[model samples]
Target chain A: MKFCSVCSSEVKQRIPHGDNRLRFVCTTCETIHYENPKMVVGCLPEWQDKVLLCKRAIEPQYGKWTLPAGFMENAETTEQGALRETWEEAGARVEISHLFTLYNLPYISQVYLMFRAKLLDLNFSAGEESLEVRLFSEDEIPWDEIAFLTIEKTLRQYFEDRRKGHFEFHIGDVERRVK
Target chain B: MKFCSVCSSEVKQRIPHGDNRLRFVCTTCETIHYENPKMVVGCLPEWQDKVLLCKRAIEPQYGKWTLPAGFMENAETTEQGALRETWEEAGARVEISHLFTLYNLPYISQVYLMFRAKLLDLNFSAGEESLEVRLFSEDEIPWDEIAFLTIEKTLRQYFEDRRKGHFEFHIGDVERRVK
Candidate 1:
C-alpha cells in the first residue's frame, strides 16, 4: 500500500506505536491501512462423467490447462467467486458440491479454495481469459500439462478418491512454475 | 497504488492516462499495487446434532453468542479457514460438509463464505477468542442474542436444510445486527 485510500497521499511503512508489525500509515492523513491477502476460489467442476478444465489464454500459464478460477471479487463469496470464474473462463454453469480443497500459500500471501462441483449444463466457449474450454474424462486428463501444481494436485486427488468412493481432502502449497 | 512495497514511494496505478476510476500514480518507484477486498471464510460446526456456539470475548461482537468463524488465513483454504476457526474458537474438530452460505456485505467491507461442518468429536470448549462454548439443539439456539447475524443465519440455514435432507446451497446478503 503505497498511497492512502482516504487522502491520496504517500503512505509510509512503519511499526505503529505499541505494535511490532509492519503497517502502512498515510503520511498526510495518518490513516493506517491494513493489507489483507486475497483469495482465489473455484471448483473441480464435473459434468455427467467428465470434469471441466480450461486452457489459459493469458500469460503466466498461457496455453496451459487449468480449472476455471480467479481472485475473489470485492463483494463476492468463495462459491460465487468459484462459479463466476467458471462461467467467465469456461462458460460453464456449475453447482458447487462439497468444499474439497484448501491450498494456503503464506509465503506468497494467497489462498486458493477448491470445491467439488457439478456441471449444470454442457454449453461452453472460451472467454477472454481462456484459450479453450474442454471436458476430460477421468482417463483423459492431461496430468503432465495441467497448468498449476494446485490444479493438478486437486484433479489427481479428485480422481483417485472418485475411484475408491472415498474422498480424502488434501492441503498443500503450490510451488510449481510454468516452463 | 503507486509506490514500492518496500519504499512506499509513488509508482503507478495501471490505468490509462485518462482513466476515471480513482487511482494513484506514484512519483517515485514504478510499481503498481491493485488493492482488492479480502475474504473471510468460516464454518458453523455441529456436534451430535447440536450446533456449536461461542461467546465473543473481543469487540465487534463482544459478549454475544456466535458460531466459530474468522478470516481466511494465508496458510489455509476457505474450508481450512472454516475448520481452523471451529477448532480455534470452539476447541472442536469438524469435517466440513458443504458450502452452506455465501454472504456479500460490501458495507462491512467483507465477504463471508461459511460452510456447514459436522463435529468429528463433541469435546470442545471456547478457545482464546471466546468466553464460553457449548452446543444447542436447533430448538435451543440463542436466536435473539446471537453475536453476528451471519452466525444466526448460518445456523438457521443448516437446520432448514437438514429437513428433507435437502442440503443445497443459497446466496444472499443478510442485514441483521446482533446488538
Candidate 2:
C-alpha cells in the first residue's frame, strides 16, 4: 500500500508499538493497515458418480478446468459463499453436505474451503466467468489440466475416500511449488 | 475506505462491470478494492482435565476471560497461526491435535477456528495482551465473565465431548445476538 485509505497520506512499513510485525502505518493519521489471508470457498457438487467442474474464461489459468470457487465476500458464512460461487460459475444449485477439504496456501496467503454438496438437477450451464461447465466422473476428470494444486489434492482425496466407502474431512497445507 | 491506497485518489463505491457487489473503485487509477471476511485462529489448550483461558488486557472485552486468539496473518497456515496465538497470549506452547470447532460470525465477518491442543508444559504466564492466564476445569469456568460467544460455545462443547469420551469436529454459525 502506497497511501493511507483513511487519510490519503503516504504510508511506511514499520512495527508499531507493542507489535512484532511490520505494518503499513500512515504518516498523518498513524493508522495501521493490516493485511490477512483471504479465503476461497467453493463446492464439489456431486451428481450420481460425477463431480462438477468449470472451464475458466478468466486469467492466470484460463481455459483450465477447476471447481467453481472464488474469493469469499464479507457478511456471509463459508457455506453461503461456497453455494454462491457454485451457482455463479456453474449456474447450478447444490445442497451442501459438509466441509470436505481445507487447504492453506501460505505462499499465496489463501485458505481454501471446499464443501461436499449434492447437485440438485442437471439444468446447469456456464456463467460469465466460465467458458463451459460439465460433470466429470473419476476416470473422466481432467487430472493433468486442473487449474490449481488445491483443487487437484481435494479431488484426489475425495475419490480416495469414495473408494474406501467413507467420506471424511481433510485438512492440510499446500506448499509453493519450486519451479 | 475513503481513498485509494494505490494512487491516493478519492474512491467511490459502485458495482464494477460483471460484478454483483459494490466495491470501492478508485477515481484516478480505477482500482477496485474488495473486502472480505477474516479468519481468527487459536487453540484450546488442554492440560489434564483443564483448559486454559486468558483475561484480556486489551479493549473490546477488557478484563473478560477468553481463549488466546487473534487475526490470522499473512504467510502463515491456520495451524501455525493458532499455535502463535496460544504462545503470544498465554506464554504457552502446545501440540495442536485437530480443528475442534469452526464458528462463522457473519455479522462481524469473521470466522473463528479453535483447535484442540495439548499444553506442552505449565511454565506459562500472561502475555502482553493478557492480564492473566490460567487453567480452568469444567466446573471452575467463569461462564458469566466469558468474553465472546464463540469461545463460550467452544468451551461448553469441549467439556460436553470430554464427558462423552469421543470428540468430533464441529462447524456452525454464530448469529448476531439480539439485544
Candidate 3:
C-alpha cells in the first residue's frame, strides 16, 4: 500500500513490535495493514449423473468452463456463499449436501471450498458473468478446457469417489505451477 | 476506510456495477476495496487423553482459556497455519490428523478451522500471546471460562466422539450471543 487507508499518510513495510512478519505500517497513525487469504466458495451441483459448469464471460480465464464459485463475501457462511454463487453465475438453485473438497492455493493466497449439492431443477441459464451454463456428465466433461486446477482436481475426485460408491471429504494444496 | 491506500484519495461506499454489495471505491483511482471473512486456523493438540489449552495474554479475551489459534496469514495453507498457531501460542509441535471442526461466526465474519492433532512432545511452555499453556483432560476442562464458543463446542465434540470411538468432521454456525 502506498498510503494508509485510515490516516491517508505514507505506509512502509516493516515488522512491528512483537511481530515476525512485515506489514504495512502507517507513518502517522501507526496502524498495521494485514492481508489474509480469501476463501472462494462454490458447489458441484448434481443433476442425475451430470454436474453443472459455467463458461466465464470475465477475465482470468475468460470463456473457460468452471464450477460456479467466487470470492466469499462478509457476513455469510461458506454454505450460503456457495449457494449464492451457484445462483448468481449459473442461474440455478441447489441443496448443499456437505463440503466435498477444500484446496489451498498458497500461490494466489486463496482457499477454495466446494460443496456437493443436488440441483433443484433444470430451469437454469447463464448469468451476467457467464456466457453459458450447462450440465456435463463424467465422460462429457471438457477436462482440457477447465478454468482452474482446483476445479479440475475436485471434479476428478468426485468421479473417482462416485465409482467407489462412496464420497469422502478431500483436502489438498495447489502449488504454483512452474511455467 | 476513510481514504484509499492506492491514491490517498477519499473513498466512498457504493455498489460497484454488477456487484450486489457495497464496497469502498476510491474517488480518484476508482479502486474497489472488497472485504471478506477471515479464517482462524489452529489445532486441538492431543496427548494421551488430554488436550492443550492456552490462557490468553492478549485483549478481546484476556486471561480466558482458549485453543491456540489466530487470523491466518497469506502464502500459507490451512494446515500450516494451524501448526504455526499451535507452536506460537502453546509452544507445542503436533502431527495433524484431519480437520475436526468448522465453525462460522457470521456476526464477526470469521471461520474457525480446528484440526485434531497429536502432540509431538511435552517440552512446551507459554508463548508471547499466552499467559499459560497446559493440557486438560475431559473432566478437567473449565467450561465457563472458555474464551470463545467455537472452542468450547469443539472440545465438547472431541470428548463426545472419543466416547463413541469414531470421530466425524463437523460443521456449524455460532450466532451472535445476546448479552
Error of 2 at B36 (Å): 0.8
The candidate that wins on lDDT is: 2
* Tens digit per residue, CA lDDT, model 1, B74-127: 545567677877888889988987677767675565767788788887688888
Retained true contacts (fraction), each candidate: 0.30, 0.89, 0.90
Give i-RMS (Å) per prediction. Answer: 5.0, 0.4, 0.5
Root-mean-square deviation (CA) per prediction: 5.5, 0.9, 0.9
Model 3 fnat value = 0.90
Clashing residue pairs found in predicted model 3: none
Estimate, for each residue in A59-124, the C-alpha lDDT of model 1 and write its tens digit: 887889999888766555577778888888898888987767767666567877788898888788
lDDT of 3 at B91: 93
lDDT of 3 by residue, A12-57 (tens): 9999998999999999999999999999999999999999999999
Residue A18 in candidate 3, Cα distance off native in Å: 1.6
Report the lDDT of model 2 for residue A54.
99
Question: Global lDDT of each model?
Answer: 0.76, 0.96, 0.95
Clashes of 1: 6
Q: In candidate 1, residue B159 scores what lDDT? A: 88
Docking level for model 1: acceptable
Stretches of candidate 2 exceeding 4 Å from the true structure: none
Please, what are the lDDT tens digits per residue for candidate 3 over residues B1-179? 99999999999999999988889999999999999999999999999999999999999889999998988999999999999999999999999999999999988999999999999999989999999999999999999889999999999999999999999999999988654
- Each prediction's DockQ? 0.24, 0.93, 0.92
User: Residue B3's C-alpha lDDT in candidate 1?
Assistant: 43
Q: TM-score of B chain for each model?
A: 0.85, 0.98, 0.98
